[model samples]
Target: MSLRLHRIQRFVLSVLLFSSLVCVSCKSSEKITREVDPTVEAYSIDEDKAIDRLSEAIQHKTVSLEDTTEIVYDQYDDFIAFLEKRYPHLHQKVEKQRIGKYSVLYKWEGNESNLKPAMLIGHYDVVPVSSGSDTLWTYSPYKGAVDEGFVWGRGTLDDKSGIMSIMEAGEYLAEQNFNPDRTIYVALHHDEEVGGVRGAQRIAEHLQDKGVELAYLVDEGLPIAEEIIENVEVPLAMIGIASKGSVNIELAYNQDGGHSSMPPRSSVIGTLSNAVNRIERKPMKASYRGLIVETFDPLIPYMTYTQRLAFNNTWLFRRIIKNKLSNNPATNAALRTTAAKTIFEAGFKENVLPVEGRVIINFRIHPNDTVEDVVEYVRDRIRNDRINIQVLDRARNSSPVSSTKAMPYKMLKRTIEESFGEVLVSPSLFIAASDARHFHDLTSNIYRFRPIRARHEDRSRIHGIDERISTENYIEMIRFQIRLIENGAAEL
Candidate 1:
């Protein structure tokens, strides 16, 4: 009988141990789910009127030129007046102030004075359509043609849509007399394409002088990326929590001039060319760290079985994962700093051996590295005492990485889920710079998101030929802005 009791006890203990192991495995791989609002209503707009307003705004030709003198100030004035005429209610209801000659700031007061305000920012500047690419476009670059369900133009996708959606949301709220418990600030910067020094920077200083602390700031950035990952087919909404830095380094080699017929064994051009080739061949080391790792963590659960196995066991598959990510240009950029040689100057005539040769390389720095780090890496790779390096412009460091656990982030996530059902949301790093980078001093909660559906095919259209946005997508953008404003300002 004692032997029988021992057998039964052993069976029970084995079962309990098996159950505990299963529970632990389940807990380790659990997927996070958010509670979403099922009946969140979409905001309505006058479709024809909205499209007409956008078309008119695009026709104004408020293009940002590298040389400020080239910009037509009259066009900017006309665009501002057009905004006032189109959205009279917003102008009358909100206190408007012009900063830095052209940037517009609108303040909407709330009942609660103690609550910090929320900010919505967008830039109106559009990159110039390259001189020779006009023939490639299906529609006129500045005509703002609304055809076959797309509003086609230079500013359509780059950003005029972003600012217009914000204005439409504000006009809707103001017309309905919707009062909030927190203040709201709308900043429309005019010079973002050219670095935003005069527009966004001045706005930040003006707000700082007034002693204002923001609850959150939202700017134009990552869209609802469709089929972004290799094995993940679902649409993913990427919110940019930080941005990379930028630096321009000029590498120059100077030697005594000589006739091409009597060139030295290594001329200035030859040495500089060799340095460029070496730097390109030996790039900065790419690693899976910082925001890139954070971005991939939540995606594991949704990946295909093979992908899931590979991602879940990163210790064993680290090399495989890095190799796969490095093969693609987009993913490769997410992995490390990238170098591009943009400008190169040598002898004006082929028969002359120039005394000086220069190459300007631009680097988009990863958050893990700094300007000094990039400079050191380049110098080490070149290893040529003859090459003199000069930093041509002010180098910017990586912006502070905002926390994913903050209340503003939570609110932003919930609003996105509520607006677009059953989509995966992830915190990502913005590869490009935006106006929000200037507001790092005011708040730690800066989010970069634009609620437009973007796919791989639409990649080249941005700042390229055939730039456009679908009319339906524009409506969705308006709905998203309205939801964000309503939910983001609600009392916690």
Candidate 2:
């Protein structure tokens, strides 16, 4: 009887042990499921450090081919060396190549195969500081001063912010021992200010030689605007679906040479002036169409219910919407291709009644439109066949719109959502050009967006005086980049 009792006790103990083990295992599984992954957080960046780095970068004065002696080459070289020293891990790990005299390229290897890599691009060069405006600047152009949470200098807003964000993100990821599933490239071009012929063009050619087409390329163009549309100031993260083709139209009228005292019924200047006025009077059709419509669709969700409903009723609401948004130049550029008379060449001497006079009209052609189309459009507007039309220089129109529905776009959207909470994500048409066009031949998915936000006045500072970006924005830009890299890899 005692032996039987002992067996029962041992059996009960074993059952209890088994139950405890099962409970512990279930608890461990639940914990694993509950824990969230690390993601980009807003306003959590090290502001001081970011400001320090930005300040140093600005002080370098890496202005593009614009100095008096044109001795900016040494400054460019020193800047490259500075990057090498700043990012030792990136230099040691990634394969490095110099395309143009100052174009810097670094490639980071990843895990998975078959997927084309992503290219993150930024220009290291800046426009020259204005010569006459010594007092116009709050801080010297190359001073790199940090005051009141802002880093003041040239290139801060134009592109050095982009370079800083890329480099910092790379360094952070390298430190974390993070290896992505696909290759990543970083390109810093020096001649973007002068038109990327020597900088971005060279990098594109080198990649083409390797038979490499990017899955998508991201470059610095437009950023998040606060009030892109009426009552819709969500982060307008423009993945440049396309950039407008450019055509330079010169209007000229020939008249018999005469003194100002003996002018004809209609002089060359008078005719040309009338034609220019006529062109201005009849503006490009500002209808919401093609890529411009595509750009507006994503923001509809973020709009208020009334605005959302209005946005949905495309036929009834587009004209009303366009009129409401047309008040601002920046916003107007988003809606349609723009034409401006940027330059004019007429009399040799100020007082002379020259026989020949010309006015140059600059047109940013919409993607669906071509140089020929723009020329025709100009001709039709002028109503005067006498005006000489010429194509000074043109680039093949931008790539066809990439699939915003694709995984890469979704990943970018997710990254933006994670990085800048509650900010709206949308595609936009870029009036300005970027290097993204070069990759379109290889891959159809090219996006142009920089993770930064600027107010209305700050936008002008891009190529203008006192160009700057906030330290907080700079750090967030880096964090967003890290998020992008991680999310991009996860798909593979």
Candidate 3:
């Protein structure tokens, strides 16, 4: 009996030891912290004047339309004239050239001519307010109203702020007689809202023809995301190292038109609806690879205990995590190639069945997938020979992933750290298309980030109503741009 008791005790001790080991292993490893320097001088600008300038920029109705011919050229011309008049110093210092008909490129010559230059790009074009939604706006979309400590207007958020901030930084620096070690090019595209086919594409081609090698290209993308990850409420400054590709697939089916009273079996509308349902039910596969993994790896330590446990042991919890992420629309977009049936057409009259049914599905391709891969997957999923599939408009594959080890990335990260103290920084995949796509051939190093403090509430405000930026956030953007410019010129 004593021998039996001893064996039981040994077994209990072994269990206790194993449990303790598991607990220790599951805890977060080591915390990494970045030191904020007290000696680093903070850049300041005229807050009132800056706000006024951004307000004025918003007043110009430089809206980009899907149909290029519908764009108001006079508005763009007026906007350009406004910039020239307002930033007299910048206009005099930088050699400015208009690319295509509306886009403008400004080159600031650095003292060190041999070094490859860095480029800062943003589009002046803003998406037009949806028709019949004008009554919903608190302020007129084009009025550029400054009230309640926010600049309210159409371009206030989805990127006139970026353009104004960069220009503000340059104008301020130029006035200070500050010269950089590397040249800087500012490309302001007017057609980024409509695919940038005319604006950014032309600028990139012109630069390529001139044999200008860029050290890095910075464009508008991921902002300083607040409360991005659940349970980790700390703001994350996400730098987009790559952007997702976009493709529109058209699924069309034609059938003989007949009276609604004697509807034939498997009508075109019915067939098309079934195909869409099938595609939606079985979406593109989600994987924990590429940017999704890269983004979460560094953030694991900052996550909650349960989240840390799951993320730390991706091998066991990957399926669970993927499912959880896939359930949420925002996280799902980050994980897989998302498909949305944007446009659907069928019968025009109530009593008549239409002969043709057309559905336009847009897919934002993940970096792991290609345009062809997306198309093939849709074709195979539908499995209907009668339903014809065709690529619509322009289709672009994902941009090549930029290296995190490059100096430009490091410089950009460091500048962010210095500007916004103690914020977590990580590389993220941009799920939307940007003008940076045009610059992929010009340089391997392209970083997409705009230093705006964005919260979940700001998401809808971007292209939706009441688009505005807080006065303080606007100042932060200017300071970030200033630091980025200075960092680009600093010694490696």
User: Scored by Cα lDDT, where does model 3 land?
Assistant: 0.87
- Lowest lDDT sum, 10 consecutive residues, model 1, at 23-32
- Ranked by lDDT, the better of candidates 2 and 3 is 3
Candidate 2 C-alpha lDDT tens digits along 363-478: 77766677777777778877877767666765355447777787777777777777766566677777787666655666777777877786687777877877777777887788
Q: Which scores better on lDDT, 1 or 2?
A: 1
Report how far residue 362 has shifted in candidate 1, in Å: 0.9
TM-score of 3: 0.92
- Index of the highest-TM-score prediction: 3
**TM-scores, all models, native as reference:** 0.91, 0.87, 0.92
List pairs with backbone clashes in candidate 1: none
Stretches of candidate 1 exceeding 4 Å from the true structure = 1-39
User: Which rank order by TM-score, best down to worst?
Assistant: 3, 1, 2
Q: Lowest summed lDDT over 10 consecutive residues: which window, candidate 2?
A: 27-36
Residue 380 in candidate 3 has what lDDT? 93
lDDT of 2: 0.74
After superposition, the stretches of candidate 2 with alpha carbons farther than 4 Å from their true spots are: 1-38, 42-46, 66-71, 301-309
Over 246-316, each residue of candidate 1 has an lDDT whose tens digit, in order, gives 99999999999978898789888889999999998888888876677777776777765556665776655
Model 3 alpha-carbon miss at residue 85, Å: 1.5
lDDT of 1 at 327: 79
